[model samples]
Target: MTYFPAADRYREMIYRRAGRSGLKLPAISLGLWHNFGDSRPADRQRAIVRRAFDLGVTHFDLANNYGPPPGSAETNFGAILGTDLKHHRDELVISSKAGYTMWDGPYGDWGSRKYLVASLDQSLRRMGLDYVDVFYHHRPDPETPLEETMTALDAIVRSGKALYVGISNYRSEQAAQAADLLRELGTPLLIHQPSYSMLNRWIEHDRLLDTLEAAGAGCIAFSPLQQGLLTDRYLTGIPEDSRIRTSVFLDESALDNQTLARLHTLDDIAKRRGQSLAQMALAWALRDERMTSLIIGASSVEQLENNVAALGRLGFDQSELDEIDATVLDL
Candidate 1:
């Protein structure tokens, strides 16, 4: 089928600058972490990607180790880009990260310049692109010198392999250090990607946004739905098709009785506000203006629509916020 994006995409999605950078990203971005693997149907993946672009979602986030087989997500996404989105390359913001273990050998993993460079080359080949709009370090490497990782990212930008560089899962102090090093190299940290949601709030405790704001970098949150714990799908119990049952990332014990009670109470609150728990979770994550965007994963077009529709009601009354603060998990 011939794919033509909707003309009103720009009008539908609101864009925000990444820190003080000249680039702007849509408020909601799509993640290819779980659903773009080779195990999933190709047509369904294409449908989800196409629908996301039609709804004004211009950013698609990926990583070298996203798929079950490690590199299949980038391969699958590349296929879509070559066919459906071939001419729309300039209209999209594509990002991929390296740092996780893609192969067994020591050189195949971590933030060493050798790994970062080779991994991105493989990624560009997989995506069939000359360069990604944004390239990320994926996660902080424990053993690698901070200077080595930041310089690798800077070198990537200079080589025209990535337009901007970012870091993920970094704490406040680590982010600040990376920002300082990148600044010295003249490629300021563009953004930070971290886990944030009603249930998972480590970024708040670390004041990561404060670090990014101080560094003039933007922030994008991942796992805003808390691995399906914040959605109505788990209110009664885990469905057969739920990630808890089908995937290894989430443990089945996470849906224990106490957690189910918390989920129900949260659902009640969302219903009073005329939104589903998933929608409320997303809106809650984006309530702070400092949160530049969120990356959500969807297995179907309907799920993508439900997640993107959250933008229609991003604001929360003080009382609603207070109620949320009082009711949410202490974590």
Candidate 2:
């Protein structure tokens, strides 16, 4: 069957400028970190991508080693692009990252020029892309010079392999340093990807958000649901098919008595606000105007639609925020 996108795809989604960059990303971007690999059915992955686009999600985030087998997610996404989204390429903001353990060799990982360049080339080949809209360094490399990594990213943009550059999992000081180097190279840092959610608020405490604001860079929060902990799926108890039960990223031990109690409190607050726990979690992440988008992963179209619906109710008054702070922050 041919895939025809929804005619009014852009009507409902809210777009925000990525920092001072001219690029505007949807408030919710789709991430291919999970369920878009060989382990999942190809039809299911395609459906999720199609549904996300139909809901006006223009940005698709990926990394060099996102799959269990490594690189399979990009290959799968490439197939979807070739078949379903090839014509709509101009409407998309595709991103991929390097700096993690992608291959096994000594030069296979980290922020070295050799590694970043080779990894991105492999990523482009796997995703069948001429150039990704945003390419990121997946993490900071302590051994490698920051200048080396930022220079590599600048070279990638100058060579037309990536339209813009970003960093992920970098601390406040590191992000500031990278932003300064990129500015010197005439390729200002566009965004930063960080793990942020009710359960995980390191960005607020560490002042990374302040750094990005000072640098004029946007922020996209990953793991805004804390690997499903913020969702209702864990309200009663962990389901058999939950990520905590199956994936290493989340652990059953994280559902401690105190955390579970806090989750219930948050759930109650969500209900009062006319939203599901998951929807409230997303809305909370987007409550800060400094946050450009939230990167969400969906296994099914229904899940994608439900998550996108979070956009409908993004407001949080002072009282609601105070309650959330008492529940999540005070915990």
Candidate 3:
């Protein structure tokens, strides 16, 4: 294929308000959490990104610790930017984060001033960008002072290193505190990235959704497929090429009898809805207006296209919703 984007790429996807911010993100955003590593063919990765843009997916999410070898994802993405997406930079919303281990001991990671500042610098260098659209404190750091972390983020925004600030994996209480601190520094929180899916409903119980919406912060859900557990790929058996078969994050033990039974039940419901399990899962995640977008990571362009098709089948009748609740809400 010659790689020309869709004929009407700009009109293919819908944009939603990213909280109270002036920013608008596509209903689905591409995430470099996996598959954009140095080991993969750079040409293929570039093609995936180009295809996404052509399909109206402008928001691309990244993190400092995302590659199999660490930082290689950003380095590979940097190469892609210099090659394919360079001229179309203004149309893209690129984001990166720090707060996990990226280098050697002590100053290498977490929410410390030294860590956040240095990590953003390295991320910028790796992505070949003067500034990221959104910069995130990847997680809450209990040991580090909240003020120090917010200060580094403030400096990053003030110095034009990043246009907006966000946080990921914070509870309702922690998020409220962080938002208040950032407001004092003149950077109101913009978004919160959380791992939400049909199977994983921690945020619902914790009231984090209400908290973020109350604070006027938007949310983008990560791992909305529940690491593929909510997908049809596991309905039969775990394929060796599947993430569960290879991932340290998703182990073989995760596919116990009970888990498989639950998946089958949900699969049946998805079939009744005329969609795949993965599609149903994504639709469920995006059903909430508080959900700005579903941050999806795809290993191939086909996966990306398949996931985006869910946008067409987003509606759920009351009976379908009730049935889904009965099937997946065991906790």
Candidate 4:
């Protein structure tokens, strides 16, 4: 069957400019970190991609080592693009990162010029795209010279392999340094990807948000749901098939009695606000104007639809905000 995107795809989505860049990203972006892999049915993955686009999600984020086997997610997303989204290429903001262990060799990982360049090439090949909208160095490398990594990213833009360059998982100091180097190379940093949620507020405590604002770099929060902990799925107890039980990223012990109690309290607040826990969490992550977007992963199309609907009720008065701060912060 042919995939025809919704005619009013852009109507509902709110797009924000990515820092000082000319690019704009949808408030909610889809991430291929979890479900879009070989382990999942191709049809199901394709449906999620199609449904996300229909709901006005134009940014699709990926990393070379996203899949359990590494590279499988990009390959699967590539197949979906060739089959269903090839024509809409111009309408999409596709991003891929390199830095984590990908291939086994020494050149397969880290922030070295050799690793970053080779990994992005492999990523482009896997995604079947001539270039990605944003290419990122997955993390800061302590051993490699910062200049080498930033130069590689600048070269990637110059070589037409990526439209813009970004960094992920970098601390405030490291991000500031990287931004300075990219500026010297005449390629200003476009954005920064970080793990931020109500449960994990390191960015706030570490002052990374202020650093990004100072650097004029946009921020897109990944794991905004804290790997599903902020959702209602764990209101009573962990499901047998939840990520905590199934994936290494989250542990069952993370849902301690204290955390569970907080979840219940937050759930009550969400109910009073006329939003689900997940929706409230998503809204909370975007409450800051500094947040350019929030990257969300979904296992099912229905779940994706429900999550996207969070945009419907993003408003919150001082009392609601005060209650959230008291619950999550005081905890």
| Residue ranges of candidate 4 with Cα displaced over 4 Å | none
lDDT per residue as tens, model 1, 1-331: 8999888878878788899999999999999999999999999999999999999999999999988679999999999999999999999999999988998888899899999999999999999999999999989999999999999999999999999999999999999999999999999999999999987889988989999999999999999999888888877767898889887779778888877877888888899988999999999999888888999999999999999988888889999888887777563
Local accuracy of candidate 4 as per-residue lDDT tens digits, 1-331: 9999999999999898888788899999999998987889999999999999999999999999987669999999999999899999999999999998988878888999988898989999999999999999988898999999999999999999999999999999999999999999999999999999988889998898789888888999999999999898988777899999899888988988888988999999999988899999999999988899999999999999989999999989999988988888855
TM-score of each: 0.98, 0.99, 0.97, 0.98
Instruction: Look at candidate 1 and tell me the lDDT of residue 48.
Output: 99
- Clashing residue pairs, backbone N/CA/C < 3 A, model 4: none
Each candidate's root-mean-square deviation in Å?
1.1, 0.8, 1.4, 0.9
| Tens-digit lDDT string for candidate 2 (228-257) | 898889888889999999998889899999
Report how far off residue 201 is in candidate 4 (Å): 0.9
Backbone clashes, candidate 4? 0
Scored by Cα lDDT, where does model 2 land? 0.94
In terms of lDDT, model 1 sits at 0.92
Model 4 earns a TM-score of 0.98
Compared with the true structure, all predictions reach lDDT values of: 0.92, 0.94, 0.90, 0.93
Q: Model 2: runs farther than 4 Å from truth?
A: none
